[model samples]
Target: MPLLSYSRSYSPTAADVGHVIRVECKATKRVGGGVLTKTVDTGLVLPFPPMPPRRQMLANVNEERLTPRLRQIGVFRVLTYNILAEIYATRQMYPYCPIWALSWSFRRELLKRELQSYNADIICLQEVQGDHYKSFFAPMMEEWGYEGWYLKKSRESMGLEGKVDGCALFYKRNRFILKERYPVDFNELANDFLKQVQTEYDLDYQGPSMAAREMFLSTLNKMRQRLQRDNVAQITVLEVVPANNEMVARKSQSGPLICVANVHIFSNPKFPDVKMWQTNMLAKQLERVTLNRNLPTILCGDFNSEPSSAVYEFMTRNHVPLDHPDIQHPPPQLANIYASLDLEHNIGFASAYASVFGAEPEYTNYTGAISRIGCDYRRSLTEALLLVIRSLDRCGGLRMVHTGDADSVRRAEGTPT
Candidate 1:
């Protein structure tokens, strides 16, 4: 009799880039003293998908004029994407996708290549899973000279080991320094708002009308429940890295700071009210976070609202009256409350895609069953800055747009410069 052992391991390299990877195993038993083996190759093969072409920035007439002026201050590219979480990438949800293609192990390789190819200054991603963030993104991004932050949805874990999806933001370490960060837990904010209402009601009421107080409290409770969805946003203030010439020329070493906000709002079309409320809450949060100083702000998110919806209108117009039809959905009591919610803000955010391209793309997100306009960037002009935004479809190649806020051209939409 002879002792036998087998080694089983393989790691792919750049040489295997365009080829399929397969594995085979063999096993057998010999009656006398030697080992015999029959080999079988499994059906699994790793195929490298084609890389998308590099994105090209498209500058409109207004942007073209301000390019030289903007370059003096600084310029950076921003990318926002919703890389579908593994938990949600199910056979039932995407029946058209092959099982192997839907697996996280396989898709992550493709994502790694896609993300690196962009070479953006800042990247905002939604649907980043907790386990993957720790095991994959954080370490991998760090190696690529990026520092990242993650905020899980504010809810008890519903998936395996209490794992859930979240939003992840990464910035080039050499390009920006983190000044401050605020993790917004919408559910917590809802509870705090309810508490404020209770305190105000107690302070204002003089009469001992128990019945009236009971009714008011009940309404407040209902509103609290309605607003307590586990959505969140990450707000960070980052100071730009100054150029070598500017560093030596300036007496103050402090560089200009920009406030960047990344969010993923509620996605239920049936409850447009929830989406609207979340958007409104985010606006208020931004207002408070950037008080005292008007930092140039870049808001990125998967709003889950279309251009035609009330959410979009409120974001661009800076106000949406209480009676807007989108805020008038069912549950008579909630409807009435939403109608009087007082949705207004002074952020003065303009859609980056709309401003540069004259309109948003027909679809920012597309799938076999549903095509949607969700992820977008909203730029707030508080300082002299230039933004060159580039986007790529999940399947299509790339689209880009260049924009700026110069003294000559304050906005892409022809505001009084």
Candidate 2:
């Protein structure tokens, strides 16, 4: 026989929670007219320990008082995470962590458990390896009635072909219908921008300005090469499904649509201008997608920028001046581009954590060397939603929202704390 497989169920009781069970598999086949047998140990398996109680969601006094009214509409949860990639989780990068703890096999089981515990309607993940998404995450989410989209980084291969990491977005299949999806490759955006610039230069400078044009072209090419990092983002539009016929009748026939954008911006600190450019590009893309209709939008991901940074300022404030200090880095030429770049967006976004807790969390990520919160969620879904904020889970960040009622404008009217 080529191969055959079967499964035998062995239900365990509460008594078997911590007990270990050793298992092995044996398979036989014919090779060269002879019989070949191979046995492999699958290793010890133990029922997982009881999970700790979930952390309570923290809401401002005003929101807490309005909880009764909020619950009557609808409730859904969203989570954003930057699961450390296996390639980057090396002994050198994380010396304090045990080698076994960093292995994908061990981490995947724990990640699966942690992810499921949240029971979120939508999940945005960063640093997810291409192979891992295919082999583990996509299938696992499907088993739980979630469909997902994945986009690998678009730069040159890093050592292995399938090891490169990217961003992934998943939503509950029954809760939301996929309306549209946009995979944003920042590298491609850079290329197109440079091409446009080159064409303009060629058209403008035909005679005596040839010398200046040559110099500008040389600098532009250098900038183009520098901008080709493998960063990417995903913009998805989902139409919410009504809970019942009663709600459907109350709400519009089409149901409310949400434009959710997930991004993993470039992490290198040396190029603050690049970070600014990427953030601005995402905002422009959002403006384009939601131009015709004011679809409630939710932007969440690992931005790799701090709350006090220019990127965050532009996102929440909807405007940032050309002279913002954070956009000015050592490379004067590259910095000039961002300094003059338009940083304007009309989509009003309020940070969930800041709105609920009076300020951003102290830390959303932890490691031996550094503990930082380089991610957040911005929402303009106040027309039909109420955000219930939860404390940051070290593994990921979570935000819950209540939807369904369409006439709720009181919550969105006031400024976020």
Candidate 3:
């Protein structure tokens, strides 16, 4: 692929090979009469762009040179969505779509359509099934310009049937240089943690809101397989991701572009403090990893915690000590990603999933209790999908180098700066 970027292949499978697919965008917008349409060469377009004019400029740059800002010759268009995999899009039918078709053909098509819209390079997805992705998403994504990456774990025991919620990363062959990969090791840790943390009366705790938390932790205990990695890295370590792994980072990389962690932690009630602790662990670890280095890092994910939580406080303060360094310890050396990008103004803001469901999309895959569907279960999927895009738009630190030249399907609500 002519697309320049970082690509990663854990253990190449028949599915990992990249296929050059042509996307012919035929349409009639009055300007070019007879449905003026054409191919996008390789279908490689900008991903969910952040609002910063600089990032916008980066998004506008031709795919080839994007690698430098992306620090890998290409940009990585990632998508992190919770598909509500347990809901079984196959056997059960929704109001408008068939079960199997919704799960198989239609859902894949929905993802394909979204992928087409973004011209996304690499996609980091959650709530996916291993079987279905290989069978469907891979082949389709290949035509666009890329390979794939998925967590090496299976969610079989939780009784949360189907793909249940796992993380996967896809790469456009042209936009990526395969780098090192890390497994969150959640599977290995969940059981032990649950056993140690489970309350005597798990479903019947009598503490303040602890009963609900008990239910929440039960879900974590039940679905501990999920919540892999949230994108909170010390700006320094994230900036040097190239050093640890060459593929994701350039060989001569003075530093790495921003590294994003798309995480989804279980937002149940219990010693919710555990969640913050985990964040702290991650923060401390990133500090250890990037000590003595300067790299821009971004930790983004559905933390389920209101922005006022301890994790939020710790992350924002660069993990500084609330007390004494020896006592509470100065938070290793992590800075909030948006702040790193320039924190004076609203570097970014996140919308509740409902707020973005402007007009109903045609199809969807899943929905959570907090998320309702207007079109189909896929509506939830669609909404979740937009979260990543919204994140990018709010914070993709790029500037506009050119104007009046926008990708056809890549139109943003805002006019060029």
Worst 10 residues of 1 by lDDT: 386-395
Give the better candidate number (1 or 2) by lDDT.
Answer: 1
Stretches > 4 Å off in candidate 2: 1-53, 61-73, 208-211, 245-252, 370-417
Q: State the lDDT at 184 in candidate 3.
A: 52
What are the clashing pairs of model 2?
none
Instruction: Point to the candidate with the largest TM-score.
Output: 1
Give candidates' CA RMSD values in order.
9.6, 9.7, 17.2
Comparing 1 and 3 by lDDT, which wins? 1
TM-score of each: 0.77, 0.75, 0.45
- Flag the better candidate by TM-score, 2 or 3: 2
Please give, for residues 1-417, the per-residue lDDT of candidate 1 as tens digits: 121224486555566555555444554555665555555444534455444334457743343344332344366768877788888889897776678778898789888977897788899988888889999999999999999799999876764753798999999987788999999999998887778767877887867499998888889888988888799989998887777754453446877777888898887667678888888988898888765586667788888777667788888788987767778774786565565466998877777766657676544444444322233321122111112111111112223533322322321212110
> Predictions ranked by lDDT, top down?
1, 2, 3
| The candidate that achieves the highest lDDT relative to the unseen native structure | 1
Tens-digit per-residue lDDT, 1-417, candidate 2:
212234443444465545553333544555556555454533344554444334566534434343422333245678877887888989897676556667888788778988998888989888899889989999999999999899999965578777899999999977887889999999989988788777766776666377787778777878887787889999999877767764554456665677888888887767666877888888899888886786667787877766666777887788877777767763676665554467888877767766755565544433444332133322221111112221121112334332212222222222111
lDDT of 1 at 265: 84
Clashes of each: 0, 0, 50
lDDT of each: 0.69, 0.67, 0.40
Which portions of model 3 show Cα errors greater than 4 Å? Answer: 1-78, 86-102, 152-154, 157-164, 187-260, 269-271, 319-417
